[model samples]
Target: MKSSNFLKYTALLVFAIAIGFFAYMVNASKALSYLSHDPKACINCHVMNTQYATWQHSSHARDVGCIDCHLPRDNMVNKYIAKARDGYNHSVAFTFNTYKNAIKISDDGAKRVQENCISCHASLTSQMVKNADANHNYDDPSVATGRRCWECHKGVPHGKVRGLTTTPNNLGVKEVQ
Candidate 1:
C-alpha cells in the first residue's frame, strides 16, 4: 500500500511539473499572442525584429497585419493550420539559430504571399492576368515559368534592403495590447 501511494504521488508530481514547465514556456514565448491578429506578436523573437520594423514603416502597415499577407484566407481551419505549421517551423528555427541572416519565406509561404498579392490587387492585375501564359499558374512545377509580384515591386512593404543588421534602430515599434 505504501508503494502504491508513492507511485500515485510520484505520477501526480510528474504531471504537475510537466504542466508547470509548459505554462512557463508558453508565457515566456508569448505563444498565445500568436493566435491573435496583433502584429506585435511577430516580434516575439529577436530574429523577427528587422522584419517587424521594416514592415512598420511600409504603407501596408497602415492596412494589414503580418498574417494578412502571410497566411491563407480560405477558412479558419487552413488559416490556423498554416499558422501552427509556420509557428512550429519558426520556433524550431529560432530556437536552434538555424534560420538565415537574411530571412526568406518558405516556398509554401511564398506561394501564399503571391496569391494574396494577386488577390488583394486583383483589379490592378487583371490585365496582366489576362496576358499571362496559359500555363502560368503560381504553382507551376518550375518557378521560372511565371512572374511573382515582388519581382517588380520588391520594395513594396519590406523595402529593398533587408538583413538582421539592416535595421539596427528598429526598436521604435510599440507593443499592442
Candidate 2:
C-alpha cells in the first residue's frame, strides 16, 4: 500500500514540475507577445531580424503591422485562433531548433496575406480586375485569374531581400542589411 502511494505521489510531482517548467519557458520566451499587434513582437526571435528590418523600410510599415497582414480579418475569434496556432507552432519550432534557415510562409499564411492585400487595396485590385476583364483573353496566362497579390507584388512587405542569407540559428544579434 505504501509503495503504491509513493508511486502515485511521484507521478503527481513529475506532472506538476513539467507544467511549471512549461509555464516558465513560455513566460521567458514572451509567448504572449504574439497576442498583441506590435511589430516589435515579431523580432522577439532573432531569426526575424531580416524580415523586421525589411518591413521597416517597406511602404506597409507606415500603415499596417505584422499581424495585420499575417492574420485573417474574418473575425476576432478566427484571428486569435490563428495567432494561438502560429504562436504554438513557433514556440515548438524555436524550442526544438527545427525551423528552416530561410523561413517560408505556410500556405495558410500566404492565403491570409493575399486576403489582407485584396481587402486593404480594394480600389487598386478592383481597377486591376476591371482592366483584366476588358482585356480578357483565354490564351493569355497574364490575364487575371484572381492571382494573389504576392504573385505580382512580391516585394511589398519583404522587398527584394529574398535569398540574401540563411537565418542565423545561434540567437546572436546580427546586423540586418
Candidate 3:
C-alpha cells in the first residue's frame, strides 16, 4: 500500500476509536446518574467502601445522601474542586486497596462539616452537640459516636424515615403517569 494511504487509514482508525470512547462515556454517564445518590454506589470504587459501610450503618446514612455532605455549599469552582480532589483520593485508595479511609481532612473539611451542621440546626439548640441527653455522658469518647447532629435528633430526621411516617402524600408528592 502507498505510504499516504497507510497514514490516512491510521488517522481514520484513531478518529473512530476516539468517537467510540466518547459515546461510551456518554452512555455510562446516563446510567450513573440514577445511582450517584446511593451510598452503596459511592463504595463501588473500593477506596470509599469503608466510609460507605460506616456511613450506611451510621445515623447520617439514613438521611444524608452521599452528595448532600460531600458536595461543597460554595461556588461551582469550590464544589467541583472538592469533587475532583475526592475523586482523586478515592482512586488512589482504590488502587492501593487501603482500608484505612479514615480521612483526616486538613481540619478545614472538619470545620466545614461542623459549620454546615451547626448552621442547619441552629434552631434546635443554643449550640450543636452530640449527646444532649443526661444519660449519655458527653465527655466519654468511646460511648458516644457519629456526627454531632445525631445527638439530640434521632437519625430519623436525616434518614427520611421520620418524614415517611408523618408527612402527608399531598404535601410534596409529584404525581406521575
Candidate 1, residue 105: the lDDT equals: 90
Best by lDDT: 1
Summarize candidate 2's per-residue lDDT along 1-177 as a digit string, tens digits.
999999999999999999999999879888777767888889788778778867776888888889999999989999989988988888788879998978989889989988888788887767765665623322357763655667667678877665435333343535433
Winning model by TM-score? 1
Angstrom error at residue 65, model 3: 1.3
Give a tens-digit lDDT track for model 3, residues 1-177: 699999999999999999999989658544364336665556455344434444555566556877666566667688668767776665666567764634444455555565566555555533223535433333556654544444454353232223322322234433211
Against the true structure, what is each candidate's TM-score?
Answer: 0.82, 0.72, 0.54
What are the runs in model 3 whose C-alpha is more than 4 Å off? 18-35, 96-103, 125-177
lDDT score for candidate 2 against the true structure? 0.77
Better of 1 and 2 by TM-score: 1
Error of 1 at 16 (Å): 1.0
Each prediction's Cα RMSD? 4.1, 4.9, 9.4
Query: Candidate 1 lDDT, tens digit per residue, 1-177?
Result: 999999999999999999999999999989999999998899788787777777777789888999999999889999999999999999999989899977889999999999899889876667554665543444335533566778777677687554445543354435322
lDDT of each: 0.80, 0.77, 0.54
What order do you get sorting by lDDT, best first?
A: 1, 2, 3
